[model samples]
Target: MKPYPFSAIVGHDQLRLALLLCAVRPEIGGALIRGEKGTAKSTAVRGLAALLSEATGSDAGLVEMPLGATEDRVIGSLDLQRVLRDGEHAFSPGLLARAHGGVLYVDEVNLLHDHLVDVLLDAAAMGRVHIERDGISHSHEARFVLIGTMNPEEGELRPQLLDRFGLTVDVHASRDVDVRVQVIRQRMAYEADPEGFAERYADADAELARRIAAARALVDDVVLPDNELRRIAALCAAFDVDGMRADLVVARTAVAHAAWRGADTVGEEDIRVAAELALPHRRRRDPFDDPGIDRDQLDEALARAGADPDPDPDPDPPGGGASTEAEHDAPQQNPAQKGKPQAPTTRPSAPPSATFRTRALRVPGVG
Candidate 1:
C-alpha cells in the first residue's frame, strides 16, 4: 500500500505525537489508535513507519500482523520438513521475530482473538518470546514498538489489553470540507507520482527524523522534578485509579515529552499532557466517558500539589493545622458503635506450661 507522508497527514495531532513519542522512547510501550473508518489511522501509522525507517538508517522493518494469521505464524514453530527428513532441529522465525527492533502494526485489533492477544501481551511485557512447543524449546528477543488501529464500531477491546498500551488516541473524521478536499487532493497526487510526492515532503520528514534522534538521545537525561512526581501521584489518587501503572506511565511519558521539546526538566504542562493520554484508559469505573480524565478535578489536584500555573502566595497545605483541629474536635463514638468489640475486663491467664523438662547437649567436635 502506498503510504502518505507523515507530514502530509491531515488531522489527529495527538495520534501523530503519540507515535513520535514511542519512536523517541520505545520503553514507553505501544500506542493504540481508536477511531472511525477512513480517518487515515492506518495511513498515518504507515507513514510513521516510513519515517522511522529513514531516520534509523535501516530497511523499514515494518511487519503487519494480519488478523487471520495462525499461532505458528505469530510466534513460530518447528520446521516440519527439516524435522521429518534429516532428523535435524530447525527453527523458523515468525512475525514477532521479524519485527525485532521495529514496529508491529495490527489493524482491527479489537477483533483479534483473545488467545492471540494474550501472546502479544506476553511478548510486549517481557520483550522476548519463549516457545516450548512441537519438540522445540527456545527463547528469542521479540522487542518491537506495537501500534494498533481499531474502529470502535467493529468491537471493543478487553480492558486488560487496553490498559497495556502506554497511550490511547481517539481520532475523529475530518469535518472541515476544505481539509477533506485537501486530503483527497494530496492522496491523488501521491497516487499519480509516488516518488514526487515523497520528495516534496522529504525535507520535512528529514527534519522530523532529526528531531526524533535528538530527543531519543536526550530522553534519559530529562529530569522529573519532585513537584511533578507529586502532581502525577495526586492525579492518580484523586481519580481512584488502581495500582501504580498510571503513575509510572505518566512520569515516563512526561519525561519523553520534555525531551522532545528540548527541555532538561519536566514541568507541570508536560505532566498534564502525559496524564491526559495515560490516565484515560485507567479509569476503572467510568470507561466510556468521552473526557476520561476529569479536567476540572485534575486541575484542582494540580493546584493542591503546587502544579498550578498561577499559584496563590499562601495556598492551604495538604496537612495543615486545620486537620489537627478537626481530628481533636471530632466527637468520639462508643466502642460498640464504632464496630470494635470491647477488650476483656481482665486478662486471661496463660495456659499451663508443658511438664517436659528442658535439657542441653553440646557437640563433641565443635565448640
Candidate 2:
C-alpha cells in the first residue's frame, strides 16, 4: 500500500522537523503530535514511516497500537500454547517486541487506559522492557521511536505522562483557502493514483532521507558552547521545569537539529528552536503562577547573548493543532442564523480500528 508522501504533506514544518529530529536522534525520545481530527496528523506519521523505510531500507515498519489491545497484547504474557504443548515454561512477546527497532504509533493516545500509558512510559524511558511475571523472567532490548497522535477534545494526557514525550508539536488545519484547495486537490490526485502520486514525490523524499542520513553521521560532532549550555539551564530555571530531564533533552534535541541543518556545531538559533519543542510540555502548567520570563526579557537576553530569533517565528498554521476533536468532528450549526445557506462540511469517518476503547474505562478516578 502506498502512503501519503512526507514531502507531499503540506504545512506543519515544526512537526516535520520534530519527526526528523527523533529519527536522527532516537535518544531524544519520541514526539507527541496533538491535533484535531482530519488535520493530517496520522497522515504525516504514516508518510514519515514510508519515507524512512524507503530512505534507510529499514525493514521495521510503524507498529500501530490499536485501541482494542489488552495489557497482555501490549506488554507481554506467558505463552500458554507453548507451555501446554512443549510442557515447558515459555513467554510470548507483545506489541512492544514487534515494535523493536521501529516506530510505535498510538492514535488518540490521550483516551487510552492509564495503566497502558504507564507501561509505555516505563519502556520508552528505559529503552528496554523487563517483564517478570508468573515466575517467568524476561528481558530484551526493545528500543523504538514512540509517536502518539491525539485529538484534545477526547481528553488531555495526564501531566506526568505528557512530560515523558521528548518533544511535542501541535498540528492545525490550514485556514488559507489556496492552501486548503492545494491540500484537497493533492488528496484527490493521490486517491486517484497512489503509485503515480508517490512517484512524483519520490525524488524529494529520497533527498530528505539522504539529508537525514548525513545528519546522523554529523550528530556526534554537533557540540554546544559553555555559555550556550548555561543559557539553556537558565531558560529551564525560568520555566521551573520539574527535573533535569527537561534541561538535558533540550540540549540533545538542539544538537540533533544543528546536525540536521548540516552545521558542525550548535548555534543560538538551534537552541531557540529546541526550546519551543521541549519546553511547552515540560513547564508546570500553573494557572496562577506567571513566571517572569517575558518576551522582552527573552529578547534582551538574546540581544546581549546574541541568540538568533526563529527565522520563521510563526508557522504556516499560525495556530497549532486544534487539540479537541470536536473542532473537526463536531460542527455546531448555529440555528440563530436561519436561511443563510451555509453548507455543512462532513468528513468520512475512519473505519473503526477497534471497539471504541475510550468509552471502556470511564468514572474518571476509577481504575
- What are the RMSD figures for all models against the true structure? 15.8, 27.0
lDDT of each: 0.84, 0.83
Evaluated at residue 55, the lDDT of candidate 1 is 67
lDDT of 2 by residue, 296-364 (tens): 654555555455343453323446655455476876767896779778889999897866555555688
TM-score of each: 0.80, 0.78
How far residue 204's Cα lies from its native spot in candidate 1, in Å, is 0.4
- Name the weakest run of 10 consecutive residues (lDDT summed) in model 2: 308-317
lDDT of 1 by residue, 185-243 (tens): 98899999988998899899889988988898899999998767878888778777778
Q: Which residue pairs collide in model 2, if any?
A: 152-323, 153-324, 171-321
